[model samples]
Target: MVLIIFFTSLAGNALMICLIHWDHRLHMPMYFLLSQLSLLDMLLISTMIPKMAADYLTGKKSTSFIGCGLQIFFFLTLGGGECFLLAAMSYDCYVAVCHPLKYSVLMSWPLCLRMTLGSWLLGAADGLMQAVATLTFPFCGRREIYHFFCEAPTVLHLACDNTSLFEYLMYICCVLMLLFRFALILTSYGLILATVLCMPSTDAHQKAIATCSSHLAVVSLHYGTVIFMYVRPKTYKTTNYDKAVSAFYSILTPHAEHPHLQSEE
Candidate 1:
């Protein structure tokens, strides 16, 4: 099942990227951002699923310390980037739909580039800080992470030192990362809704609704699972349920994102 999802996500996202790249009509800011999203999804799922599948097949659940740290770094980096990228995509959609005449100027190539670069930088910064902080603590006992991947919270569970304060700090970071961007998405869509309603043509309203619905579905799936996983109290015990949620966002969400990317084109 893991291998199947892994291959499907890879193929789907790769295909989205290629289609956007090869199609001249898709050279607009929206598709450019979608292609960047596809690329990020490709990297995001690849960061964890490949190693996970390998472990599942080989019966080797254990990874070296450095390997674990690297996994967390890349996973958080891509995940964080996707969060910001989705917000940027929402704004692109807003500008395109609500201010079509100004889209060319507002969502210009340089601005798009800046947004993409900003997403990556912010994500990298979060990933680096979390990875370093989570791994630095002294871990005792068997040091086995209950979860499938080296997620920051799961890894922090093994720490011998007191981490309550740090866990609260992590929670705050998750809130800022997830909720703040989610608020941006909501604001963009709210404006979109108001604009769509004022349109005289029913056909135009319907089309706008259809497009926005698809984007919102992708956002809900991604954000809902991530917030459920990371935004909770540290006192919460890790369970198979947590693993399932992780799989949803880490594996399934990327696959879900593919259709939305293709639909944009």
Candidate 2:
């Protein structure tokens, strides 16, 4: 099942990348960021799922300390990057709809590239901080992480020493990085709705609403799963349901952002 999920997601995202790269009409800022998003999702799922599937199939749960840290590092980095990227994408849509005159100038190639780079950098830095703080703590026993991947909360639960400080710090970072981006996304959509209401053209108004609505659906799935997985207390035992939720955002969202659909719409 895990292997099935991994390959399916991989194929879907690969197709998205191909479509985005090959289609000249999909060369706008929105699709450009989405292509980058597809790439990020590919990397994010590739990092964890292949190994996890292999381990599950072979019944070998063992992972080196360094390997575990690397898993957490990539997972959080991509996760945070996706959050910001989604928010950035929403902002792009808002600009395109609300400020059509300035849309091209504001979301130029250089600016889009910078936003992409900044999202990755910020996410990496945040992930690094969490990984360092997590791995530095001593683990006397209970090496088994409840989840398939090395999630921070689950990994922290395995530690021998006190983790209250680390847990609190991680929570703080989650609030800042994850919740902050979510708030910005919601605010952008709210402003977008307000702007769309004033537009007289029914066609333009409907299209604008459709775009934002699709974006909101994606955002809800991505952030909802994440908040459910990570925000709660560590002692909370992870269920198969939790794993399923994680897979949705980690795999499904990128598929939904496939370039073919973007171009058609």
Candidate 3:
């Protein structure tokens, strides 16, 4: 099942990336950002899924200390980058819809490039902080992680020394980042809604609403599962259901960016 999910995601995201790269008509800022997202999704899922499939198939669950650290680093960095990118995409949509006249000028190529790069950089910085905190702690005995992936909370639970400070700090950072991004998403959509409502052309209003609806669906899926996985109570029991939820956004959402599908509309 894990293998099935892994390959399916891998193929789907790869196809999206190919489609975006092959089509010159899809070179707009929206599609460009989405292509970056597709690339990230491919990289992010590949980081853990292949190892997981090998482990599951071979019944070998052990990961070296260094391997575990690298997994955590890439997982958190890519995951955080995705969240920031989605928020940026939402802002792009809001600007395009609410202020169509200025959209091109505001979201220029340079600004878009910076925003994309900045998201990754910020995510890497956050991951670095977490990695430092994680590696500094002593691990005396048990190192078995219940989850297939090396998640920070699960790893922290296994530490022999106190991780309360590190965990608390991580929680603070997660909450602040999530809250700020959620607020930005909501504010952008609010302005978009107001603009759509005031627009006299019914057809234009409908088109705007349709675009927003698609974005809202993607946002809900991505943010909802992440919040559920991280914010909920941490337990030792292994659950396939959690993996399924993670797979949804990480694996499925990138396929929506395919140029063929986008062009069909």
lDDT of 1 by residue, 1-265 (tens): 7787778878887898898899898777788788888889889888887788889889999999999999999999999998999999898888877877777898899999999999999999999999999988999998898888888888887899999988888889789879999999999999999988888877777777766777888998999999988987656656887888988888877333322222222
Candidate 2 lDDT (Cα, whole model)?
Answer: 0.78
Instruction: Please give the CA lDDT of all the candidate structures.
Output: 0.84, 0.78, 0.76
Weakest 10 consecutive residues of candidate 3 by summed lDDT: 256-265
Q: Write the per-residue lDDT of candidate 2 for residues 1-265, one digit (tens) a residue.
A: 6677778877877888898799898888888888888788789988887887788789987889899899889988988888888888988987877777777798898989889998899889978988889999888855676677887777777788988987887777787777888898888889988987887777777677677676678788888878877776666745676667666766555345522112111
Measured against the true structure, the TM-scores of the candidates, in listed sequence, are 0.94, 0.89, 0.88
C-alpha-based local distance difference test score of model 3 = 0.76
Scored against the true structure, residue 149 in model 1 reaches a CA lDDT of 81
Q: Candidate 2 regions off by >4 Å?
A: 233-245, 251-254, 258-265
For all candidates, what are the clash counts?
Answer: 0, 0, 0
Better of 1 and 3 by lDDT: 1
Instruction: Write down the TM-score for model 2.
Output: 0.89
